[model samples]
Target: MTAPLLEVNDLKMHFPIKSGLFSRAKTFNRAVDGVSLSIQPGETVGLVGESGCGKSTLGRCIARLYQPTEGRVYFKGNDLVHLSHKALLPYRQNIQMIFQDPMESLNARHTVGEILEEPFIIHGIGDAQSRRRSVAKLLDTVGLPSRSATRYPFEFSGGQRQRIGIARAIALNPELIICDEPVSALDVSIQSQILNLLMDLQQEYNLAYLFIAHDLAVVKHISDRVLIMYLGQIVESAASETIYQSPLHPYTQSLISAIPIPDPHRKTNRILLQGDVPSPIAPPSGCRFHTRCPVAEPRCSETAPSLLEAETQHDARCLLINSQ
Candidate 1:
């Protein structure tokens, strides 16, 4: 059998905190405690969670934007966790990321053409004329007119700027693109446009996506598999249909119940979660979701439930279900 395109094992990203000058104390914020997943060629894995659930951090770690604190990230059968900066360059081209805000990610001073061509220039892929031609083609490929390349990011609408970001991400022909809330910054109408564009681009290029977003509806529309996150840990993961239809984790159930249905006439229930997400600096002792989990039991507060596949192909980190 062929190996997965990308595999992550026990990944963690922690940020240190400094206390008083004389005190000898080490404190760290667990942005990503322990995350492990894999993506195959042309697969779309949707990561869905509430704000500040470490979804973006996990994506960044996969793209190597931030070096992981611990664990291994293997891409194309090579471990990337310990690769030197120089050695990692080739892999950088293989994996790219699309940020949540296009305006913030794209340089305002650089023209759209320059922004798209920068990848080719960095990798030394083509000459000046060829790079310019490639930039124009990228614009056209992303549904923008060739002339739009001459404009700056601030000049375009939110959706258009995101398209530019998408164009740049695919310019390198990356095998995997970590989309970090790429559509959350746009308007409702424009969000669909960007999502559709991304889908079309994936079909054309056979690109794999680590699609991160807060909107379950959007994830349902695009993802083959969906992962539910809470407080920097994966609470549940399964095929998109299975996750929506039969969520075992309370967190997953709450999240799925919250997706707004368009039909006002159709009656539906909403699971309103109690309390805000706990601080990542001092997460709960056992299952992180136990603090807010509606159906949490006594064992939920003492022993952390491992991510186990109780049902066929469905993994949940909840004590209520049988472990793998």
Candidate 2:
């Protein structure tokens, strides 16, 4: 098992909702509640769900951007939650994040070279000349030109900006990169290029990735395991191919069915899910998907299901499968 590279157990993050002039806490948005996951070294795990399902929040917690209200996040045998800001420095360098919007992530005033070199500077690596030399090679590694070092972010297209972001993330040579919707904003043609670039970088570095995206097809192409999140809870997790071929969770089945087959001749019984995702501030009791699940049993509304392996390594948090 290689003792999993990262282990997140019963992780929870709650944002308080305050009311009145005094701002007394009224309620809390349990953005992520009792979620658990693990990522082995050199493996890519994809987190997929509709918008506002807490995938990004989970990613941030794993990155230690937000303090978890509950549970533990262990990376390479170190507990991230207990680390003081100063003590967390080394872990920060080992885990990097690639944001969704490159334009927003990259500073407009900083040249490409400066942006990429900031990490090395923060971590205090390399001299000025060596840093400059590494900058050009990094640009080349991400398929950007060395001349790009001198240009502002606005001068490049969206794809190029993402490439620059990639260059910056890898500048420190981290082992894990949390990609938050990396290609959603790019045009289709450009998206493939970015995906391929990520693939190449992973192969070259033997890096692990926690790819968070709403796109199922994209996850299918890149991930070894796929996790389906809904209302801040994971409904299913399994080998990507297993989930695509025989999804155990009702929500997962619907999601996989929604993926469009390239061949028009092949038929797919698309399951268009009904009802909006329940609010995280007050998620539904028991099984969250009972309101929309076609095969939901009466007991589903009264008991929450824990994710457990049903066959080999396939896991699903659904009462139906638990009974079977």
Best by lDDT: 2
> Stretches of candidate 1 above 4 Å error?
20-25
For residues 1-324, write the lDDT of model 2, one tens digit per residue. Answer: 798889999999999998877877889999999999999998999999999899999999999999989999999988999899999998899899999999999999998889988988988999999999999999999999899999999999999999999998898889999999999999999999999999999999999999999999999899999999999999888899998889889899898898888998999998888888889999888899998998888999999888888888888888999888
User: Which candidate has the highest TM-score of all?
Assistant: 2
lDDT of 1 by residue, 103-215 (tens): 99999999998899999999999999999999998999999999988889999999999999999999999999999999998999999899999999999999999999999
Kindly give the number of clashing pairs for every candidate: 0, 0
Q: Find the 10 residues in a row with the least total lDDT in model 2.
A: 17-26
Question: What shift in Å separates residue 120 of candidate 1 from its native position after superposition?
Answer: 0.7
The local lDDT score (0 to 100) that residue 305 gets in candidate 1 is 84
